[model samples]
Target: MAINQKSFDQVTGALSSLDRNPQAVRQRVVALEKVLERAFTVPGTQYKVGLDAIVGLVPVVGDWVTGAMSAYLIWEARNLGMSKWQLARMSGNAVFDTAVGMVPFAGDLFDFVFKSNSRNLRIIKAHLDKHHPSTVIIEGEKL
Candidate 1:
């Protein structure tokens, strides 16, 4: 079985779009990418979408948005019936993002790298693979 105990793939779901099937990964990446675009010129860019302009710079609001997004990932995992340990690991990504994202500018920096949406996507992917290795992630499945 390609099943791995670790939720690595689930945590990295944002990139799943780059995979053969792009549904799950593509949606999450696109949405988060929008957030990054509006918030910064570039996520890590010093002059462009740097972490400074990111909403993560805002203490309460930024964290709320980030948390909400993270919860979506967890909700997906629940629908997939992921194991508790897997869900916890997925939550860890969200928790880390919320906690560190609370920082002033530093949180934005964390968001750039941590990428809660991407992390959640990864968790979802991992859960899918672990639970249903034969499954193919098609766009319609999202509907």
Candidate 2:
């Protein structure tokens, strides 16, 4: 099998352990989203930011590094069997974030506001809720 397929199967298999504990999967997703996009709040402002934005301050290399981190969320969504369209949209968000994020000052500012990982996580949650309801965790209870 292709390496990508093999790695995907491994991820799917690993995630299957949480089939009877959907709350765990939900927790994982939520934690990852926070880490990637909402780890902190700006003082005296309603805005929040995370490590993705922090790392993105290193000029050219920073955006690429964070882009790879963002890809992990999409990879997990694929393991959950999200549709191609949803996956494509998620990829686009990351790509857009990364591309514009390479623009120095403006990119750092954009990263603070764009928050692509959080957006992608929301999309993943919506897809799971609507199409894979079995995997959704609702109010500490597995739906």
Candidate 3:
């Protein structure tokens, strides 16, 4: 039991450390953006779709859920000490997505193309690259 407890504690400690690490935050935000905006490719089409498009098929609740997820990215940005203007821009993107996403069918179509999370991810990446250069990820290179 003590061994098991020790392992669990180690895992939780690592996760908590990740919470404070800018690189971990960048990785998390990038993964979330991929999940929200480009999870899978559409059959017979080059276009990709993610939860933002799929879950957005539902009426009100889906938009709320995805909007909350988008807000998480903004929260992480704030934790990274991002400027107010950047935070406001990210918030505006999320709000616009949520607002337009409330519409019935048109909103579903909009979600497939708009990709607000991707936009916000770009913003976060820019900030991280400029301020926390060590967090910048090089594609195809192991860290």
C-alpha TM-score for every candidate: 0.57, 0.77, 0.86
The CA lDDT at 28 in model 3 is: 91
In model 1, the Cα lDDT at residue 42 comes to 38
| Candidate 2 local lDDT, 53-143, one digit each (tens) | 8989999899998899888788778877788999999999999999999998999999888988888989988977786677776686765
Writing each residue's lDDT as its tens digit, candidate 1 over 11-52 gives 567545434333544455445544543344534656444232
Q: Which portions of model 1 show Cα errors greater than 4 Å?
A: 1-53, 137-143
Model 3 pairs in collision: none
Model 3 alpha-carbon miss at residue 31, Å: 0.5
- How displaced is residue 4 in candidate 2, in Å? 17
Score candidate 1 by TM-score against the native.
Answer: 0.57
lDDT of each: 0.61, 0.83, 0.91
Find the candidate with the highest lDDT and give its number: 3
- Which parts of model 2 are misplaced by more than 4 Å? 1-23, 134-143
Q: Write the per-residue lDDT of candidate 3 for residues 28-73, one digit (tens) a residue.
A: 9989999999999999998999999999998999999999999999
RMSD of 3: 5.6
